[model samples]
Target chain A: MTLSSGTVAPGAPTRTATGSVTVRALRLLESFTAERPELSLSELARRSGTPLSTVHRLVGDLMEWGALERDPSTGRIRVGLRLWEVASLAPRALSLREAAIPVLEDVAAVTHENVQLGVREGDEVVFVERIRGRRSVRLLTRVGGRFALPPTGIGLALLAHAPADVQERVCAGPLRRFTPYTVTDPVRLRAMLAEVRRSGVAVSDRQVTDDAVSVAAPVFDRSRAIRAAVSVVVEADTGRPAQLTPLVRAAALSIGRALG
Target chain B: MTLSSGTVAPGAPTRTATGSVTVRALRLLESFTAERPELSLSELARRSGTPLSTVHRLVGDLMEWGALERDPSTGRIRVGLRLWEVASLAPRALSLREAAIPVLEDVAAVTHENVQLGVREGDEVVFVERIRGRRSVRLLTRVGGRFALPPTGIGLALLAHAPADVQERVCAGPLRRFTPYTVTDPVRLRAMLAEVRRSGVAVSDRQVTDDAVSVAAPVFDRSRAIRAAVSVVVEADTGRPAQLTPLVRAAALSIGRALG
Candidate 1:
């Protein structure tokens, strides 16, 4: 079974006929986003589109389970540490991070730049782990944050190895542009994908941000299946993408080996 | 409403009287632990004590929502990345990690050891972020992993600043010894706590592990509240705890400032 396309499916609790209560509770959680991490009880009810009574009951249960915590001062609620602890057991994120950290440390030691490990999740890249270098350029990306697959080096690297249908779907346009350098044209993006495939490396130059450039390489598991990508982001003016390419690729390979 | 000191409350779904379906479903998730990340359908049913049919229905909803994912080969289920993404927004974990990463990177660069940032949760310490140096000693702890409050440097640092009631409860005994060098005596532990409070640092030498030594310091938020703790673990016999002490303390302070 798969969730409907929208966050709250038709016949969801918001309407007269309620769907599963589990679905309604999960929708309440989904309402809390990066921009709005905390929400008052009424705000949660409004955002989740559930009635206040239902929201209060569900929130009470969630709070008791430690999946939600109330602020001492404001009476607002946020996701709880216990929830994070349980979620940390997710193999896709934490397991991969555990395997890749040592290799990432090596890459960071050499380049002293932001190092990231990401896997393709649908059409987006979800950063599983990131090692911020001591003197590297600042990045907007956060661990577990999502970004478009067309504009990031790790995204391009993962996209270059993605299935043909997925590649086609992503290249069919409506691509969001972060900067002028971001390749929004499907035709241009297709060409870049081919080049990345050929070279086994992807360079995203000032695509996500004006001052940052990232070099990324795909990682293969024991079966030689492309599993993930690793990248190193540097200041655009540094102009050392060429020098950093091998280092990033080597780290990716080492991580793949460790995953075995 | 507080949960009655166990994973599930007294009126939880386990009894003949069923609780909310949503709470029951969430309990299925709480059943997953570090020791058992993956669970077969039957195992999930048994662990959660939900009827097999009910488990089937709830698991379907969870899987559809991407809160639970099935392992391809074994058909076992595990926590999903989507859930981790949502949980990552928990301010107690991600926000603190975001502020601490840079300072941690600096500590890693200088000491090249395992640097950790942790917050107290109950009587234990939950490591929010950990940067393992390239040549650091192998550690039993992982990011999001928990350890006893008496043996780990971060744990000691956090425990030192805990409320008097919490401290008394913890020091009241049954302290598990990880190694022979571990401090199991409450009186000695209290003295060590006093020293940590006075010096704003905690050192655990060959306590949790036989071959490792760790130095830790308390982190103060803008309110001057002891919000977290930072630590660096190195191999024993290296005898540089004194040298690493200041570096870890400084990083903790820097992270606290960044948190503001």
Candidate 2:
């Protein structure tokens, strides 16, 4: 449940050069997390490590541009709707999500299980879209959330197609364990990746949790390069993971065709 | 469809000092739009108003940081998934959308019509979330899309709760017309706003399109201040808009309590 990329925590500001005003302002935005969605001026300065006066000036500029807004009653700042409007144009996430939604919906409709679409980022996988099944097993993956690339079925599928260096780095070890079935041994994980490549399907059997298992397949772009992965999670004892493999794979292929 | 704030388009670069490398680099991201979601390096330079060499350097930085990505097949640059992941932390959009999704789903289930949640931004309203009902009328609104404040039911609900200055500014307008039923007169629009406040619901009878009508109600925060609005859009001739008013109002109230 607490998976994160090794490089930066979810909302921590990056240590970019202080001379750049734009980075400083963006860092202020990064300082706001799901937990602390609102912050006062002093809290912003403290979290972003900027001078109070500089925070004031930069916040003022961002406010004027509608990148941030201050609540009239509380005087606390939150990310503005305008920022979300612009960010929605991000092709890799929004465009891909838009293309995959219908297929994911179909998968959910047929399987009645949690359906997920994810893409690899560095050594981790970021879920771009997730559909909750009405009677499916509970899932920890939230849309726009990140997870390691060795436990979840979508993660394993993405990691299987990732560059050799990324795979090697991940295989070097320290994999976090979510449940007793979660893979932690690097050798076994590497073997699992090899099997994923060989079979064109990745089945994670209760790897992330005790009560659920997932089956995933890679999605390829026109150039035949893997761009994303799709997965469906069902209650561990109810459905056979191998039997669900074809359904998930077909949905992934359908989404890839739609993307093209 | 091209509704934009006069201050700046969603992805247009602000005309700040261009000397700073960070600002120039961020400008490259701003050059992308819904109409042009992908661009080449030279096109980015031309659109962002930066020199070719400067564009090369800035694009490299952005690509390295995963703020921009190059398509392997076409070499077109696109906003990366990383940027969207970061921006997903935006509270005004994400938090509000998260809080309202359950109620929106309920409303969609009961009404079998498009359920929308929107927040006021400047003189316009930006849709934070939208749920398309199984048998709903087609809507022009999309999540993260913006529209004028005088025509749509959600817009009227948000605008009615806005400050007096905002109401005055919108009332002093040349309102665009989508259909003959769209209210273009300032006097009638003013009265409609008054009625919305009095009834706690705003009904738009074929204001946005001839085939659809929407009923909306304002969502309030724990502080008793309006935070957003929810609406249900149905086929204009198929359903009675007045009967839908209570359903929308109840959903908005449920979402308000959920937010608290």
Best by TM-score: 1
C-alpha lDDT of all candidate models, in order: 0.84, 0.81
Shift of residue A96 alpha carbon in model 1, Å: 1.1
- The CAPRI category of model 2 is acceptable
TM, every model: 0.89, 0.87
Off by over 4 Å in 2: A1-19, A50-54, B1-28, B48-64
Candidate 1, residues A162-194, lDDT tens digits: the string is: 999999999997999888898989999999999
- Which prediction has the highest DockQ against the true structure? 1
At residue B84, give the lDDT of candidate 1.
94
Which stretch of 10 consecutive residues in model 1 chain B shows the poorest summed lDDT? B7-16
Q: What is the lDDT of residue B82 in candidate 2?
A: 67
Tens digit per residue, CA lDDT, model 2, B1-260:
11123423333333345423454565567798878989987898889878876676566556655567777567788887766777787777778888898788778768777899999888999998887778979788888788999999999999999999999999899999999999999999999999999999999899999999889999998888899999998898887888887788888889999887
